[model samples]
Target: EAGVAQSPRYKIIEKRQSVAFWCNPISGHATLYWYQQILGQGPKLLIQFQNNGVVDDSQLPKDRFSAERLKGVDSTLKIQPAKLEDSAVYLCASSLEGGYGYTFGSGTRLTVV
Candidate 1:
């Protein structure tokens, strides 16, 4: 199966700066997700989108993190005033409507100093 696509495979920024990551999901996939993965830990789901609407974003940090999937095919995740603790890889994924096996991108590694 074809996989999700992500841009700027790596990024480095200072604390209190901002960064953004982009993703393009597989064709015909209705469910899209953004996950954060810190070193030594599992990926944490940050947001979910079904079609062009938000399905869940409870885990997203509203004060500094935001995401959008405007057309249901591409998405973006942004972090503003990034914190040192925010250094991690951001993964984008997608699946069929049932939430089963997901196709993930290569991920964007963000390093905050």
Candidate 2:
């Protein structure tokens, strides 16, 4: 099976800048999740989506972070007016509905200066 695809493996931007990361999950997966992993920390869930609808976004920082899944296939996460604390690896994962096995993308690393 093809793995999840993510774009722009790395990015660097000054504080208050904006950046977006793209993700294409494995075909046929119905659940998707976005995570943020800071240095020396495990990935933290940012958002969860089932199909084209949001299942959970409580952990997402609405003021600066936003994400969406279009037509339940492709997804994008954007951070606007980023802060120094926003530096981390953004990960996208997908799994079958109600399944625990998730397939993850390589992720996009963001650096805020």
Candidate 3:
């Protein structure tokens, strides 16, 4: 099975600037999730997608964050007008509905200046 893939690995942007991250989930997996991991806390689910449909996004900051899964294969997360507090590890993970451990990518580390 192909593992999740993310790009750039790291990014630095000024506060109020915009940044985006990409993700490619494992093949055959039906559930994909994006999480924001702050300095010390656990990963918080920002959004979830089951195929091309969004399953959950209650925790996502709608005012500045947006996400979409196109063709039900890959996804992107965008944050416009970034904030200093937004600096964190953006993790992408996938799991099968039946039951399986999630496979996480190395993650895109973002820093706000």
Candidate 4:
């Protein structure tokens, strides 16, 4: 199976700066998710999409974080005016709808100085 693809595996930005991460999920997968993993902490669900429609975003910080899956394929996540606490790895994952297995991308690491 082709793995999910993410770009710019690492990033560093001063506080209040903005950054964006891109993700391309495996083909045929209908569900996609974005997660935030703080250092030494388990990944937290940021958002989830079924096709082009959002299934869940209750954990997303809409004030500064936003995401979209374009036409139900590739996706992007953006964080504006990043805070020091936002430093972490942003991961993208995808799976078949209602499937148990999830394939995850390598992730983009953000450091807010």
Q: Judging by lDDT against the true structure, name the best candidate.
A: 2
Query: What is candidate 3's local distance difference test score?
Result: 0.93
Q: List the residue pairs that clash in candidate 3.
A: none
lDDT of 2 by residue, 1-113 (tens): 89999998999999999999999999999999999999999999999999999999999999999999989998999999999999999999999974498999999999999
Overall lDDT per candidate, in order of appearance: 0.94, 0.95, 0.93, 0.94
Q: What TM-score fits each model?
A: 0.96, 0.97, 0.95, 0.97
Candidate 4, 1-113: lDDT as tens digits: 79999987999999999999999999999999999999999999999999999999999999999999979999999999899999999999999964469899999999999
RMSD values, in order shown: 0.9, 0.8, 1.2, 0.8
Worst 10 residues of 2 by lDDT: 95-104
Q: Candidate 4 has what TM-score?
A: 0.97
Off by over 4 Å in 4: none
Question: Per-residue CA lDDT of candidate 1, range 1-113, in tens?
Answer: 56899999999999999999999999999999999999999999999999989989999999999999888789999999899999999999999874899989999999999
Instruction: Flag regions of model 3 displaced more than 4 Å.
Output: none
Clash count, predicted structure 4: 0
Can you rank all candidates by TM-score, best first? 2, 4, 1, 3
Runs in model 1 deviating more than 4 A are none
Q: How close to the true structure is residue 35 of candidate 3, measured as C-alpha lDDT?
A: 95
